[model samples]
Target: MKKRLITLCSTFIFCVGVQAQEFTPKQLEQVKQVRENALNSDLSWQLLESITTEVGPRLPGTENDKKAVAWAVEQFEALGFDKVWTEPATFPHWRRYHESARIITPSEQPIHLTALGNSVSTPEQGITGEVVLFETLDELIAAPQDSLKNKIAFINYRMNRHVDGNGYGPAVRARNNGAVEAAKKGAIAYMMRSVSTTEHRFAHTGGSHYQPGVNKVPATAISNPDADQLERLISSGHSVSVNINVQSEDLGEGTSYNVIGEVTGSEFPNQYVLIGGHLDSWDLGTGALDDGAGVALTMAAAKHIKAVAQPKRSIRVVLFAAEELGLWGAKAYFERHAKSLGNIVAAAESDFGAGLIYGFESNVTANALPIVRAIAKQLAPLNIEYIRANAAHGGPDLIPLRERLNAPIFALHQDGTDYFDYHHTANDTLDKVDPIKLKQNTAAYAVFAMMAANSKNKITNK
Candidate 1:
């Protein structure tokens, strides 16, 4: 009983010390105001609807990509941001013209599929061959050389659903390199189950690559239901043959721009908090859930913070370019700003869909925990929990930023259980985004950015 009393007293003292080191009451009130304003406003939804509706799919280097850049600049200017600019990024440009597949032997029926990025085109007439099924990529690799001769290799791996989207990595391995492995086995084409968690018939499309020595074959993904059908037919001892037709082009190198908007600070203008999402998305979808929500909410968050309070450090929202093809924009941004990396006091990105932010986390030095905790406290009213992992990988766009230095990074984790359902598919439209959830996401970013900028002590790297 005596030991328990001592422990309770120690806990109280530590809490009091942390509270003392954190924001003042007036600052806390400002945070409350920002949160409330964000929740009450429909700015985020308006931005999301306008961008997704007006710009449509923003595949890099397309005319739509150019329009997206102009749209972002116009929006930033209209939002009264202090400064707006663009940075150039170059990437290998590829486009899909048409993709179609169907079961030819055993039964005749259409199968839904989309060509993977960087996939080579099939012959004009397409390729028809016996179907060779592999449950996993490793199984395909282990098959004897020429085992898949005159066959189309198919991998039927399914991704599991999780709130944090942990299954994406495991399932995407096949999507990324299954084609290369299949080509090595003398396959004429490669196909796999879509890396999705949906029952719908929308085929998902994403990035894939070809190796130097290996023959480049057409890579594609079929809808989940179609994959199930193929599995059933093959399991029933039927000789399944498929015809795959994909017409695509590789346009060598192309350039895109990263749109940037800044809200300057009064005190430490050079030190900044970076937050945003990739602007470029797969052409198959409108890119609403994949990144349009991220773009809109982050843009609105900075606008809200600027309206309510003049932060001590600047806030920069970067709409990355060519992210769907690769992290090209992120790489260029970090490389161009490499010398000033240490000036980035705090950074976060929202590439996940417009789900409620369920948790807040930071990857920073021990001394920065007080600021993180204070920010988490402000986020608590929005039903966001503090994840003490201290290992926050903000988003795909921040990958380059993280690789450069031990930069201060943060993540406002959204509920991604249904994000993969519409991700990279035609179903990722504006209707999938909940306005209420977007406002909550906006409020979370607003509070986090405002507090990080206005903190008494500067956030630091680990």
Candidate 2:
């Protein structure tokens, strides 16, 4: 009697679970169709190849960056969207040039390094100083001003790899704030281990911050192998010195555009479902993963949905510009579209890379949770589940919309387990992205985007 009762109770719960995830029969059929089509399509790969091959790295406000904006506009129009447009995103331009680093103290050896974004150029003859090593950023901060005076601070921080990309937070702080912290101590220059998991000799380049009214210093990142070499030298109980020459041009104010495309809704045309990834990438390799995969993923999702059927709310795809330079395009997007926040049903971004999306986390209103639950159920074919994360910021490009506008955000959390290995480095090329997993991402985004557009649910709430 006890066993029978347990079995009956379990069966009841399972039935209720299925019932709670209920979608209209037509909606269920559409989800199935979208997933199947996405899985079978190679359009995503083709689109990705086009950008990475033709335009290459889209460093902020450069000529290549302008070409990227144009390419996105053309691609969106070719995809046969009902509307295509561009919005202005103006910001100061920064460009990297010839840079080199060599250890001169204990032994003479070359170290692979690259200048961080917006880093001021070093002296014409370069700069050399004794190395002051720190295991972490916190340690560097705690160092006395006199300790680092007239020296180069070497911050050797290692990043842990995780499927959820949790390690990037701790490791990236070294890149983002190390320069400012070192400058506070009167360091002549700054160098740190690349904020990546891989030990490839390629250095990772990213943005570094300098406080207003604070002295700016040249900052660079050394490859993991190079960092290891420096560490071994330090452990030998001997003083180490290095010479670094970094040249980056501040090209002054420049203009870029946020690319936009739309698939008009069949019923509630004013209501919107937005999906995108940043169009800009760091000036390394071909920008294939940092955001090239993201752009391809969202575009392919919208394309698959349009090929299958139309939804009740419009589907808008944005290929935002200047994301690498601090999400300037996204901020402009919010400023231009804040008035339409009420009409936007939901927003999502696929910026994490071309990894398989294993979960769906949303920040929509309390009432809209069930809507996403139903969407998650539809995504089961792609193995995507509904994880309880209401604070989803969609992606970096959606920050303004998600935070200031109180707009809802949905994120298809990709398995970024190895993403940092190639991120912001020359290894971030087209070959790193798996076409099969990329399509699975398209399927996941397609189902959610189409379903969100078609649903009668309201997304505007706290």
Candidate 3:
């Protein structure tokens, strides 16, 4: 009976010790000061302007992507980061030569369209055939094979707007697997309604994953307006035929790189607070909002910390490569630095568009929730909320790190109501991003990153 009582007392003592280690009021005040400094800095807008104007489009495995790598290294060195370097990566080289689609029968008209990235080209003369329209993927799968044999299959999937932009997952399947599925049913070519919210005549282009051992077919996306027109023509009971010619080609393997920079910590130089955004973009538009804002935000946050010159833990910044094609850059980094994954205290990514952050979440040990909560208290003044959910999506680029290294990931949830309107479309340019909102996002990232880096607590696997 005495021994049982002693064990209970020891357990109580341990709990009390943990409670005493929580952040004090003074430490929270320091985080607030960091947030203020980030908001006042002009680095976000300035860096964005330079990248969009000078680098223009940074397609993977191309000269533009290389120039972007050089530009990032120079910029980080100029910002007085302690160390700046590049990690080698190999990515696929895809070139969009020329793309066009036209309705050949029943009042001929040209349709606005963009070829999906990494999609193969049609024959030199292009493919001309009768068009078969399906409202959804299920309808296509259930149709008689004779109706689609040697014909062009058009899949129309609509994207609905939401505050959280939850519609991207299901709507994007057409872009990813539509070609393979259509080919299995003996389809000669495939076309899909662009996955976007707006009804503009601008088509959206994104990466499509082709399953191995499946016959690949030419696939492209048409604008929402064009899809509506095509559907109307089919409803009139007239047989419609169209000509699709996409001159995309894959140049053999090409070289690319991931740029990295760091501000060494005063006390724990080996420990790291890793932050990043992918540097590669699609070829169509200027690649401004898809990732230009992300690059600018991370750079600005790191610069702000260096300007103060008193960071308690090292802040590491990585500019990933070929995120649009595949997560090659992140995969290579994890493989090369497999030994150092344990020392990586935390990892955060800024891939979503530059909108005001609404909340923060992390996939860490339950014991680490208090540390995250204390950081949240500092951001509450900016109207940001805290959610206890801890499953980390980690963005598309961080897939390798999340799967292999088991790294604790942090997500700064941003307002994405308007994100899908311009996503993967030519309309995703600089004008879409608001300067004031960009500053607000920068401030939130700076505060969270600062607090996480300085805290002595470690976010281990739950």
Per-residue alpha-carbon lDDT of candidate 2 for residues 1-462, written as tens digits (9 for 90 to 100)? 655554454433223333234456777787799889999999999999999999998998778888998898899889998899999998768888889999998889999999998899999789999998999999999998767889999999999999989999899899899999999999999999999899789999988877897789899999999999999989989799999999888898778999998999988999898899999999888999989998988898998999888877899999988888888888888888777777877889888889989988888777676676778767876888778767776788878886767777788899999998999988999999999999999888899898888765556545
Model 1 stretches astray by more than 4 angstroms: 1-17
Summarize candidate 3's per-residue lDDT along 296-319 as a digit string, tens digits: 888888777677555677888888
Q: What is the C-alpha lDDT of each candidate?
A: 0.92, 0.86, 0.82
Cα deviation in Å at residue 279, candidate 1? 0.7
List TM-score per model, in order.
Answer: 0.97, 0.94, 0.93
Arranged by lDDT, best first: 1, 2, 3
Q: Which candidate is the best by TM-score?
A: 1
Task: lDDT winner between 1 and 3, please give it.
Answer: 1
For each of the candidates, the C-alpha root-mean-square deviation to the true structure, in angstroms, is: 2.8, 3.6, 4.1
Candidate 3 weakest ten by summed lDDT: 11-20
Pairs of colliding residues, candidate 2: none
Model 2, position 139: C-alpha lDDT score = 99
Candidate no. 1 TM-score: 0.97
Which candidate gets the maximum lDDT versus the true structure? 1
Which residue runs does candidate 2 get wrong by more than 4 Å? 1-23
